[model samples]
Target: MKEAENIFLNLINQHKGIIHKISKMYMKDAEEQRDLFQEIVLQLWKAYPTFKGNSKFTTWMYRVCLNTALIYFKKDNRKVDKAPLDENIDIMDVNENEGKEEKLAYLYTAVQELNAIEKALIFLFLENQSHRDIAENLGISEVNARVKLNRTKEKLQFIIKKNGYEF
Candidate 1:
């Protein structure tokens, strides 16, 4: 039991960045992001016993994290107020320069307009996952994954451009 606990902790610590990115990609607000992050960790802990070593830890983790994100919507207290555009936006990378930061900020902002599955596709694609890997993670055919990804990219571009920034 002790060895299992230690192994789990070490694995989670090593991959904590992936969890943070998933939480951030799914939740826009800082507080909500934190809540979702905890929820994901809890879910992972609950499901950890089922991880048979058939796949890489990250491949398994991606399925769990993305599923949690898809189902982790707020518990019914919908917000009617919107934050102003000038409010601080969290970039995926902290070390990027101002120019790239601004671009990434806008990109993240545009990403919020995407549907949950679309967001997952874009997130995985950005992670450089192959089409087959994405298909496996998404539980879809490889051709379907490619088609959906291409369409999602077009839609994301349209959303970004509609928000007045050139692609």
Candidate 2:
């Protein structure tokens, strides 16, 4: 048991960023993100024992984390006010001048406007997953994945423009 615990801790420490990224994409509020992160960690630990070595650990982790995020529901459905958008912000051009943090913040804000499946597509795309891998992960046909991804990108660009930021 101690050996298993140490192994889990080591694996988690190495791959914890996956959890953080999923939580960030799925949640807007800091407190909610933290809670979701914890829930994902717990789910990962529970599912760890059943994991086989057939797939890469990170791939398996993505499946678990994404599943958790997809099904997670907030207790309250109340909407929170979003911060006012800056009229001059351009996501595509701004990233070149901004620091990584600012670029990431801008990306996340843009992503928050996406629906759940679109969010999943963008998350996988941002990670540079191949269409095959994304389709496998998402359980869709590769052609469908390609089509959806193209459309999702266009939609995201449209959303950014609608929000006064040009991509």
Please, what is the TM-score per model? 0.83, 0.84
Assess candidate 1 and give its TM-score to the true structure.
0.83
RMSD of each: 6.6, 5.5
CA lDDT, every model vs. true structure: 0.79, 0.77
The lDDT of model 1 is: 0.79
| Candidate 2 residue lDDT tens string, 17-38 | 8889888988889999899999
Colliding pairs, model 2: none
Error of 2 at 51 (Å): 1.1
Distance from true location, Cα of 143 in model 1, Å: 0.5
Q: Which ten residues in a row have the lowest lDDT in candidate 2?
A: 82-91
Candidate closest to the true structure, highest lDDT: 1
